[model samples]
Target chain A: MVAQSTGADAKNPIQVIERMMKLLDVLSYYHDPVSLKQLALETGLHPSTAHRILAAMGATGFVERGEPGSYQLGIRLLELGNLVKSRINIRDSALPLMQRLHQEIGESVNLGVRQGDEIVYVERTSSGRSSVRVVHLVGARAPLHVTAVGKLFLLEDGLPALREYAKRTGLPGLTPNSLTSLPALSRELDKVRRHGVAFDNEEIEQGLRCIAAPIRDDSGDLVAGLSVSAPAERHSANWAPLVKQTADDISAAIGYVKPDQPAARR
Target chain B: MVAQSTGADAKNPIQVIERMMKLLDVLSYYHDPVSLKQLALETGLHPSTAHRILAAMGATGFVERGEPGSYQLGIRLLELGNLVKSRINIRDSALPLMQRLHQEIGESVNLGVRQGDEIVYVERTSSGRSSVRVVHLVGARAPLHVTAVGKLFLLEDGLPALREYAKRTGLPGLTPNSLTSLPALSRELDKVRRHGVAFDNEEIEQGLRCIAAPIRDDSGDLVAGLSVSAPAERHSANWAPLVKQTADDISAAIGYVKPDQPAARR
Candidate 1:
C-alpha cells in the first residue's frame, strides 16, 4: 500500500514520519544539545519543518528542548534502552566472568554485540588503576572493521558479505593501523577464524589494543564478543588463551557445548 | 504554537503524532511482544490508526515486528540509550569509586538519578560471587518513595513536595515494610536528613535491602545517589560509614566541596 503512493505528495504523513526519523538520526550522532537550525541543516529539512517535527517529538518525550531552541534525545529513550538491555540475558550471564577477567588481568574487559555495521559495548569492567582511560566504554560503538569485537562478527560473515560491508561503509579508518583495504581486512579475519581470537592493535584509537573471542549461545552460534583491552605497550598475545577460556565459560553457562571438545573447561 | 490547535483535524500532523506517542507508551508497558489488536485496544485507537503509526515506527527501527503479528521495542532504542548513557559523565566518575565500595563491602553498588517520579539506575557493579540477584539493573527505574536512593531525593523535596508526591502516587506499597503512611514516610525522611544515609528495609523486594547516600555536584546540589545493596540477612548497618565515605569521595572527584569540610579527600 505504501509503495502505491508515489509522486509529489508534500502532505504525505509517511514523508513527515521519514523527516522525523532523519532528525532523530542526526540527534543520535550528537552528545550535546543541538539547535533547530543545526538540525535543519543536517537533515536538509527547512527550519520550520524541523521545528514542527521536533515539537511533536518533544510532546512524546523522544526529543527534549534544552537552551531555548536547542534539543536533545530524551530520558524516555534511556528508559527504553534499559528495557532492551535487560531483555538480553547474555549481558547478565557474561558480566560475572568479565569481572573475573578484569580482576585477573587488571585491564579493561568488554562485552559487545553486533548492531548492523557497528559494535555496541553492552557491558564492561574498567581498569581501575590505569591513569589512561580505556576507549571501549559501555554503550560505545565502532565500525565492524576497526574493533576486535567487530571483527569477530565480520569473520562470521563470509567474504562476500564483508566485501559488501566494506563498500557500504567505505572502510573508514580510525587510526594508522586500521585496515583500509579488503585484502588486509580479509587476512585479519582469516587469522581470527583459525586462532579463535581477533586483535585491535592501535586500530580504533592510538595506544590502545584489544583481544577478542567469540561468545556462543545454546545452539553454538556466535552471540557476542568478550574482549580484553589495554594500552598497546602492555598488550600481550599471552592473554589469548585466558580470554578464550573465559568466553568458552560464558558460552557453556548459556548452554553452548563445544562439538569438538567433549569435556570443556568450566 | 501547539496550543493553537484545539479541535481535531484529520489532516493535522500533531494529532497523528499524538496517536504515535500513545502507541509507544503502550508498548513501553510490556516486556513481551504485543499484537496490533492488543495495542489498538489498550490505546483506544482504531486498528488502522495504530497499524499506520506502528508501520512508520517500524521503518525508523523504533518498533520491531516479532512472531508474525506481535511487536516489540527495537534495538534502535538500545543504540540511542547507549548514546544517552555514555553522555552522562557522572557515571564514569562514580564507577571506579563504586567498584572500590563493592570490593570493600562485597555487595552490589549502584548509581542513580531522579527522572520525574522515578529513579533511574545509571551504573552498577555486580557482586560477582553472590548467588542472589540484584534487582536494580542499569537503566531500571522505580518510584521515588520505594528505593533507598529515591528516598534521598524525597528528603531534598521538603515537606510540602513530599506530601504532594504521596498524594500523587498513593504511596503504593510493594511489601509489608513499605512506607505506605505519610507520617511514617516523613519520619523516615527525617532520619535520612539527620544520618546522611537512607535504608530500604525490604521496601521494594521481600529479601533485598539497600542503603544509599546522596551524591552532590560542584554547585552543592544533590545530583545523584550511591547505594550498596545486599540480601536482608547479609546487610549490615556498619556499611553506613563506608558508603558515606565513598559517596563523599565521588562527590569530591566531581569537584563538589562541602562548606564544612575544608579539606576534601582525594
Candidate 2:
C-alpha cells in the first residue's frame, strides 16, 4: 500500500535516500529550533510525511525531539565531528595555547583553516570577561580576503595559488582598509611571509583589529593559522610583539620549530 | 552480482537499508581513528565493498577521509549535534548557572535528563582544581538506581511507574551506600519529594557527595535535574543552603517556581 501512490519510478532507492537527505537539509537550515510543521512547510512535504521522516531521523540519533513537536540535530553528530577534529593536530594542540593567549591578551583567539575558498574557524577561545564582546562562534566561516586568519591562510598557500584564488573569488572591498587589488594583497602576503604574521586593521569590522600567524605541520607545510582579535583601541602597535610571541609559543607547542632555533628547543 | 548474493530476499528494501545502517554501526565503534583495512576486517566485508560504503558516506557528509586510508566522522555531524544541544534548552540555560555553582562550590556541577531507564548528562561544568570527581560527560548515561540525578528523575516519574521500573530493572548497588532494596529506595524517594532535593553520599563514588534538585518545564513537568559534586570534606553540614540556592536559581531560570510561592513571585 505504501508503494501504491508511486508509478513506475516509486521504488528508486537513490531517490528515496535523496529525499531523506533533503529533509535533513531543511532541518539543518535553522540555527534555532524548528517545529515539524515548519519543516513540512519548508520542505513542501505533507506534515504527516515530515513527521515520519523526523521520527526515522530520531530513531537513528540523527535528530532529537525538542519541546514537544520541535526537533534539532543530535549529539551523535558531535561524536562524529570530534573524530574529524581530533585528527587535525594543529587545532587540538593550539586550543590550550589559544586559551592561555586569550587570558594573557584579554581578547578572543581563533584557529582557522582554509576549506575550499572560505576560511573555516576550527577553534576559538575567549576570556570569560570579554566573551560577550566577541560574538563569533566556533564553526562559523569567513571570506578568505577579509579577516587576519583568512589572509594568513591565503599567504600560507603562497603567491601563485593566492593570485588564482583571489582572481576566482574576487578581491572585493569588505571595508575601507580591505586590500581590493591582487597586487596589494600579494605584497601584503610577502610581508606576512617575511614577518611570519598578518594584520587586519579593521578590514572585517570597523572597531575590530587582529594579528595572525601561520601554523605549519611537521613537514613545514602550512596547515592552519592562529589569530587574536581585540578592540582597535587595545591593539596598539606595541601589541604586535606580544601577539607574535603567543603565536610562536602555540607554533612550538604543535612541533613547528623555527629554522634558526637550536635542536635543544624541542 | 550484488543482487545474486542476497538470494530470494534480495528485493527487500528494509534489509538493504539495514545493511547500510550496519556499516554505520561498525564505523561508530571506533572512538580513535579507523583505517579502511581495519574497517573492512571488522565489518567482514570485502575491501572494495567497505570502500564503496565509505565513499557513499563521504559524499553524503556523514563521514570524511582522514589521513590517507583513515576515516573519521565529519563536521556536518558536529553542526547537527550543536543544533540538537541548542534545542535542548535546559543544557544552554543551565550551563552558565552550573559553571557559577561549580566556581562557588569548588566542585562539579551536572545537568542531566531521564532517557529511558537511564539518565544522560546534557551539560556538566567543573572547577578544574577539584580532586573529587564524577565521570559525567555530555551524552554519557548512568544507571538510574545509583546516581543522584538518576534517583531525582526516577522520583519525578511518580510512584506507580517507579515501582514498575524498579521491578523490571532491579535496584542494583553501585557502591555500598547505593540503595539496593526497593522499599529503602522508595522511602528515600519519598523523602526527596518532600524536601524537593536529593543527595548522593558516596552512593556513586566513595568519598564524594552530591546534592541534586529537579528542573521542570513551563508545564510544571519534571524535565531534568541539576547536581553539585564535592569532596565529603567540602560537603560539611553547612553546604546545604548554598547548594539549595544554586538549585533554586537554575530551577527558576528553567521556569520552575515553588508551589507555595506568592502570586507576585512570577
Candidate No. with top TM-score = 1
For model 2, the stretches where C-alpha displacement exceeds 4 angstroms are A1-13, A44-52, A66-69, A91-266, B1-21, B44-50, B66-69, B91-210, B213-266
In angstroms, the error of model 1 at A199 is 14
lDDT of 1 by residue, B1-266 (tens): 24333234334456667677667766767777899999988877878878877887786667888676688776667666655655657887799899998888888999999999899999999656666766788999999898999999999999999999999999999999999999999999999999999999999999999999999864467999999988999999999999999999888656455666422111
Q: Which candidate is the best by lDDT?
A: 1
Fraction of true contacts retained by every candidate, in order, equals: 0.45, 0.27
lDDT by residue for model 2 (B1-266), tens: 45333223323334333344445656655555689898777656777867766665665556667587888665455444434434456777788888887777777788888889988888888556777565677788878878878888888778888889888988777888988888988998887878777888888777787788877753357888887776776775455566667767766554444555411110
DockQ of 2: 0.10
Model 1, A139: alpha-carbon shift in Å? 29
Best by DockQ: 1
Q: Give i-RMS (Å) per prediction.
A: 10.8, 12.0
Worst 10 residues of 1 chain A by lDDT: A1-10
